[model samples]
Target: MQSTASTPELYLAELPEERQHIMTALRDVIRENLPAGFEEVMSYGMLGYAVPHTLYPAGYHCDPKQPLPFMSIASQKRHIAVYHMGMYADEKLLDWFKEEYSKHSNTKLDMGKSCIRFKKPEQVPLALIGELASKMTPQEWVQVYESQIKR
Candidate 1:
């Protein structure tokens, strides 16, 4: 995966064939589920969706040119990771998501603080992933970032 400095289109074009397939599928799923404020961009060597600053000036703090990312999709060496912003401060929701994932996914879903890692596309539960993606609204994402700083 290329760095965020790479243009989103270039990054997509440069992805390995396998990773490109995974990224494209993930991108379509995410785009279909996320709200209107979410715009695709390259961040941390992956595709990420963020809110435009015109909607919230304070959304871009560290980088005035970039908006606040709520979710991201990365191509790791052995797997793809779906990064969720909800884990930043919402432990209860995070735990609930983990439990829900495990309950329905038969223990195949692997997750960390915010990233859900999986090697094969078949291993991913599309419906459950969609549910998880829907949890963090733009307002909830801003709250998570603020609470993260407090901690």
Candidate 2:
């Protein structure tokens, strides 16, 4: 569920106890695998990784005031979600993510253009998430985003 919690600690505290461990594990995977130059912050009311303005200055193309978001993890009304912006640009990555997720997970992967949805921690494929997380450096993300914008 979308929360009023401003910080990651508060966000974690507000989640159902049963959900906390899963969320923490997913957050850990993102944190551990994310490249340098990406900052973790609350964005779109979720735990988000973004390209900070100090580094990019361009901000997000859609909203210059906001950082360029790479990914976000949040508890939604019915499911947990990880929004991976990279997949929208790289269809191969999206396909590979789905294939790997299916190979590793017992649960069906319910995904949209950029959002992967799952009911529980077990539904998530942590290894695939880590591989995706590790693949994009902030510079690569910027290039990908810029390319999309130019098109």
Candidate 3:
């Protein structure tokens, strides 16, 4: 479910107690591993990592006032989700993630174009997620967004 929380801390606080640790861990992993230039912010009511306007003043094509989103994490009704725009814009990244996920997780990967869903918190592979977070730099993401996804 989309959260109305204004800050990352508030977003974490709003999560159910059982989900707090995993979500916080996911946030920490992303923060520690994401390449420099991506700022952590609350976007679209979720915890978001984005290329700030200072870096790319064009901002998001869909909403210029908002930063260009690179990744986001949210607690859905039935699952916790990680959305990585790199996987959606780059097929090789998607293929690599699918392959690596098989190696790291015993459970089948549940995913959409950009959203990776984990129904069980124990099944979340933190290290793999960290590696994925580190895979794309903000400049690279902005380039990809301009070339591939932006209109």
Question: In candidate 3, which residue ranges exceed 4 Å CA deviation?
Answer: none
Task: Return the clash pairs for model 2, or none.
Answer: 1-75
Best of the candidates, TM-score? 3
TM-scores of the models, in the given order? 0.82, 0.94, 0.97
- Deviation in angstroms for 42 in model 3? 0.5
Task: Give the clashing residue pairs of candidate 3, or none.
Answer: none
lDDT per residue (tens digit) for residues 46-70 in model 3: 9999999999999998999999999
Order the candidates by TM-score, highest first — what do you get?
3, 2, 1
Alpha carbon lDDT at 26, candidate 1: 76
lDDT of 1 by residue, 1-151 (tens): 4455467667667777877776777777788888666678777677888876766677666776778877888777788788887664688778788788876676466777778898776676667666777777777777777777667
Error of 1 at 121 (Å): 2.5
Reference-based lDDT, each prediction: 0.74, 0.88, 0.95
Q: What local lDDT does model 1 show for residue 101? A: 80
Instruction: Output the number of the lDDT-best candidate.
Output: 3
> Model 2 scores what on Cα lDDT?
0.88
